[model samples]
Target: MTRILCIGEAMVELSAQGDLWRAGIAGDTLNTAWYLRRLLGPSHHVGYLTRVGRGDFSRRAVDFMAAEGIDTSHVTTDPTREIGLYAITLTEGERSFTYWRDTSAARGLADGPDRLQSALVGCDIAYLSGITLAILPDAGRAALLDALRGRDVVFDPNLRPRLWPDAGRMRAAITEAAGLAALVLPSFDDEAAHFGDADPKATIARYRAAGAGQVVVKNGGGPVAYGGPEGSGVVDDLPRDRPVDSTAAGDSFNAAYLAARLEGGTCADAIRAGHALSRRVIAHPGALVRAAV
Candidate 1:
């Protein structure tokens, strides 16, 4: 059995809906881990590596992950910090999020990568997001990158500009992350904003130069481009017919692609699986839609 470790924050999310609200847990890596568990079932083990507060919300999140068959053994509980919270506002099928996550316990998880590194040794694949690196202090980031040296790592540059102090630091961190990743999954808009890439091919070239064996550039509502040992090219004519909400499109796509690749699907087949899953994800209201696993 193969294990996939997802390292990042998991925050409580509240979404407004017709004078009422719905609550769930959501974060980039967490969302991917959840969807991966749903897609792979018991055959592939999924683990979430992050710290949470010793609070009710945190407890609920742990229970939820357990129910979803995600391994929570690496999830640490911190007494001092409180779990982070975010609110989602949906209007006409478009969603925007406001976060209050400055004190998230995940910030501290990065500080102690030595303990995590030992636990991660048995994992077949490790997945992380740019937001995971952005929340860490300089020392924590260094420790994390060092810990991931020889693993089949998947990097998603789920870039949130507001998380970084400046653009220069963001670019530097992303560049470093790209070099460490065996597979790089980046959104076209994020790559362009941070690295000044003009198109998907340019973005793939940028990551390939950084030593990534595989590069997948996710362009919203447009064709997705990919490059790997099997060769590189674009899979065109994939415009979302009616993209309901672009919330977890990229996250779900990453999960589906990785899952398919792990199942021995070709890069093109993996991208098609990614497109199919993302199309279903966006048709719902929240980040983790309550659908059949």
Candidate 2:
């Protein structure tokens, strides 16, 4: 079986539903893992690596993964800390978040090098994101990067400026992390805002120069630019409807794109697959949509 391990934080998510609030479990890497679990069949094993607390929310997060057929064996528990929480506010299909994660247990996910190494053992692909590094301490990021060395790494520079101490540190860390990935997926808008990339090609060029084997630049509901060993080209995104919530568009796209690539599809074909799934995901209300793509 092909084992894929996604390393990052999963938190309790609250979204406004009419006059009340709806709660669920979701995060960037976890959302990708969830979509990957659904997209890939039984032969592919999807695992999660993170630290949560003993609280009810934490327990629910673990149980959610188990219920979705994702491997939760690498999920470590913290006795003193609890899971992080975020609330979503959507305005005309666009969403924004308010986070409460300063003392999140996931900040220490890479504290033990031995545990990190052990968690990665036998895994075929290790998937992480910019948020993963942002939440981690400098030493933790170093340890995690060290453990991920030489693995088939899939990275997403899911840039969040507030998460990092400064722009320079975020760029340096993202560039360093991208150098370790076999595939680097970045959103063009984020790259333009943070890295001052002129366009999607510029984003792809930057990552390729950072030693990444392949790079896919995602443009929100527009054309996708991708390049690597398999091929290089632009694939137009699937025709999309008015989105009810665009929360997990990129996350689901990454999952589907990677799933297609892992199943031997070409970069262009994979980009199409990613866009198709992402189009379906944005029509739903939450990050983890319960419908099939």
The residue-level lDDT of candidate 1 at 140 comes to 87
Query: What lDDT does each candidate get?
Result: 0.87, 0.94
Q: Which 10-residue span in candidate 2 carries the lowest summed lDDT?
A: 234-243
Q: In candidate 2, residue 102 scores what lDDT?
A: 98
Candidate number of the best lDDT: 2
Error of 1 at 102 (Å): 0.7
- In TM-score terms, which candidate is top? 2
Residue clash pairs of candidate 2: none
Clashing residue pairs in candidate 1, if any? none
Off by over 4 Å in 2: none
> What is the number of backbone collisions in each predicted candidate, taken in the order shown?
0, 0
The digit string of per-residue lDDT tens for model 1 on 141-171 reads: 8898888888889999888889999988988
lDDT of 2 by residue, 1-293 (tens): 99999999999999999999999999999999999999998999999999999999999999999999989999999999999999999999999999999999999999999999999989999999999999999999999999998899999999999999999999999999999999999999999999999999999888999999899999888889988776788887457577889998999999999999889998888889998899889888999987845
